[model samples]
Target: MNHSSLDSTMMLTSFGSFRPLNYFFFSLTLLVYLLSIFSNVFLMLIIYFESSLHKPMYIFLFNLALNGLIGSSTVWPAIMENLLSDTQKMSFLACLVQIYWGYFYLSSAYTTLSVMAYDRYVSICKPLQYHSIMTPGKVKTLLTAANIVPLFSIAILVYLTSRLVLCKYTIQNLFCDLVTILNLSCVKSLLVNLCGACMLASLVVFPCTIVLLSYALILTVSLKASKGAQKKALSTCSPHLITFINFGVAILFFAVYNRYSSFLPAEVYILITIDVFMIPPLLNPIIYGIQTQEIRKCFVKTVRKNEIFFRICELTVFRKSTSEHNS
Candidate 1:
């Protein structure tokens, strides 16, 4: 391809594989995107309004839901747009924007989960000091760090990526990805790869280590505690654990697919791509909403309140109609 031809746009070649089932894929993707938005937004709203849930753990959960929403919104719009359209092209600037947000979401997500792990560690292992250790000010600081660090790091990566001279314009995956973008570069830079490695180390690997160590300590404490305490600890950590494992799987697929996509069949490649975007945002809310007792109770309460309001409206309507008839 001519360099001038790709000066403004990048093609997503994988989209061509699904053209035969474009309508079906579009409808399915739209449904998942809507559900992800609704679930994440609903969770955030519940945490926001329920003053009783104004605590450290729930606040982190709120951030997680917020991240999920961000992640879904970052890619799902482009995905749905391309799904319906014949051309699967994105401008270079828009691709960079997607790459920035997509990676930011991943970074902030792991960072938030690591913070949540530390919160749990304090709550379970150092119960008495939990309040002091995770003060409201500290919570704000952590949330700020979780979001800001990722934003800065991803900005650097995207900046480096933007500076590279690109000889290719086709991205193999569904959305703009840093790894795919790096692969598009005509010349290889060791500095970019080094920075990427370090970023992954600090943002992804280091946070993952924190999560593991925190849980290991939690497990040690749980093992020595009473059975009731063990059950409580399990209940508290299970949702985060499940979400982490699910996310880990998605990232693994992402790495393998990007690195070894040539060995994989087209169907498998498409499935992996869709799975990366779809599973986590869809599952995170469900996992936390169902597994976290406080959120579950709040949801029930909110539903009951709505039901009561609807019943009151029905009764008022009936009374108004009866009075009008009698008159």
Candidate 2:
């Protein structure tokens, strides 16, 4: 696995010498990555262990957690290595793979979110047929679509990207991402840009609108009911909404900043970090861990259980390092 280091991380712009505070940001980001790994793993395990959470919403949560785990794992390690290294020179192939996975989970998250919207739609709009419409077969079909639909998009974007000659591999952003990379190409990346714009629309715009519209209808239906009924309905879905916000806000921020910014100095760099790369992993687990009670309980229980197991292991250790030290 070719890992990219940070020494090659330079933009084509004039901000050639202003080294953004690397130690602080690097340490902070590493801590965030560790937290993401810890929390997301716990969440996935909890969803697996707790049968009650195997329903529509929590299942979506599980899928989201898993998607985040893989996506962040692919990108952030390389990012951290670059930040700390003297020279962050990522190989061509590694860069391509990174871009691929970035697009993959992004699209997957969109598809899953849209499916969740439809789940809500059926559950609310046609309450009588909710079970029938979102049945095992139907859910499986939806799952298949989620998996397959984005691959076609990725194939097109990546193909266009491969044709472009990379004149400057010095990426402006912290990580070698699609936006930063496309900016470095010699040819007009307008087609690739269009591809990105279209994918963003399909993945983010469409699903978010559906989620909003479905919830609007749901709210309308529930508002016509007793106070108790409305509260209960809202309570059931609040976690999913938070998840949507976590992913959606970052997506929105990136969509706005990337299109508008003319690759300005620190302005563009900071925006890319916050919106595209840094925030989503940090937010995913927190939103899920806080909002989903079952996940929270299971996570606490698992932590306690693991602590006990670690204590036992520490007592039984072969003490290989200590043995070497003593010798």
Candidate 3:
């Protein structure tokens, strides 16, 4: 096999067997992609327009929605196009670009969730100092760090992986993931793997640990508070918790799929990969909008206002049509 040929193009084997149902899957994927976009955009709009929601929590929520949009946009469009095409091949550089953006998005998602957990913890356990501690400057700094750290980390990983000579070009996943790309390296990359593992652990495990500890503290404080206070805390924290758990499960499935790819069937592996990209973006806004009182109220108010506006437009059109017919 020519090494130059391997360097030129890589095949994504994940969709090789789905040719028969490509159109069906394409339609379904497009719908999911659109729903994810709409949900996140709606959440962001509500947060942006509602002055009442200008607090730190909603600010982080807005960033989370934005991250979801970025993450979905990074992969779904390519996946949809691949579903419609006969070839599942991508250039080597394109694969690297996908891997970088995909991992960067994942890192940012976890980091944002962890930050949101800390925000809730501070709000609940130290309400008096919430404004003082989570000031606009601080929130801005935290958001900057969340994004920068991930970008830097993934950049290093991609750089190291890119230096390797390739022995293979086929990736057995739905998308170009770092693990699959690393597996194609011709040379033994123990150091690369170890460095990648450390990066992954830092990006994922550290933030998750913070989230768990913060939630534990929040729960402890909630136990001592009154029923109403507890209910309020629960209402606020539940959405974050649900989103975190959903994201955590997806990450777990991803880890398992990577480590034990041989044991799992191709279909199962494809579904796991799809779930990682699909579920969080689709569910986060819905969970937050329904579970958070302020968001839900705003959503309801917005919907009702839109309904009234549409009704007035309909009446105007009806009268105009009737007048034109009479004339």
Candidate 4:
């Protein structure tokens, strides 16, 4: 398809093979989407209301959950719709919007993880200076940088992508990623594309490097400290480390699949592509919720509160019914 032909609509070939199981996929997608939203939202709400969780670490956790909600919201709803509807298509403008938000979310996630790693490092490696360094002002600044930098980077990418004349309309992946969109461009502006790729790489690499350094320093400090200190540091850093490793692996798989998509079968390609987006959002909340003691306590408390409320309501209804029957 030419630029004019793609001006209005672009087809998503990602879900084409799953047409026969559309309803099945629809139900599954909807369930996962709702679960992800609920988990992330629940975590954010806990952090928001719990005064004890107002520390720099939890503040970053809140932002991480918020990013998960935004990122998952960008694509899952569209996927759910496509599963229900016969057409797996979106408008060119809509596609661009999806691409922008999807990448924005990815960038935000990496930046947030980097910030969290730094927080852990300070807390574990420099316990005396932790509060002094991670003050409200500093935390606010970090949060601002984390959120704004991603938006700025993604906007440049969207601008570059929007200028490309389309050679095809069908995107092979489950969602509109920057790489897939570039592949569809008729005019392969190699220089511009190379520069764009470098910019994107910097976004990933800079933050990842910071995270690695922070963890390395933390590890070195832990080795010299007492056993209690080492255990404390491990407890605090384990969740962040798990999340980082999980996200890194997912992105690596996605990058490899995109580069070697021609070698993979349709089923394998689809699974790999979807894993990039699907796994992190769902897994992050679960990993954090279970692993972080404060979050786990808050979650249990909230659940208990709801259960008590329901029991009280049931008792009220039962008493009311008995009184009315006696009357």
Better of 1 and 2 by lDDT: 1
Candidate 3 lDDT by residue in tens digits, 109-150 = 999999999999999999999989999999999989888999
Estimate, for each residue in 218-303, the C-alpha lDDT of model 4 and write its tens digit. 99999999999998888899999999998888777877877788888778766764566677888898998888888889888989
* Candidate 4: stretches off by over 4 Å: 1-6, 17-20
| Runs in model 2 lying further than 4 Å from the true structure | 1-21, 189-194, 300-327
Sort the predicted structures by TM-score, highest score first. 1, 3, 4, 2
Question: Model 3's lDDT to the true fold?
Answer: 0.88
lDDT of each: 0.88, 0.71, 0.88, 0.84
Assess the local accuracy of residue 137 in candidate 1 as a C-alpha lDDT between 0 and 100.
Answer: 98
- Clashing residue pairs in candidate 2, if any? 5-88, 6-88, 7-87, 7-88
Candidate ordering by lDDT (highest first): 3, 1, 4, 2
Worst window of 10 by summed lDDT in candidate 4: 1-10
> Once model 2 is optimally superposed onto the true structure by TM-score, how far is the C-alpha of residue 264 displaced, in angstroms?
3.8
| Tens-digit lDDT track of model 2 for 109-227 | 87887777778767766779877677777777877777677878887887677666766766655554677667776777788889888987886677778888888888888878888
TM-score winner among the candidates?
A: 1
- List the candidate 3 regions with Cα displacement exceeding 4 Å: 1-7, 322-327
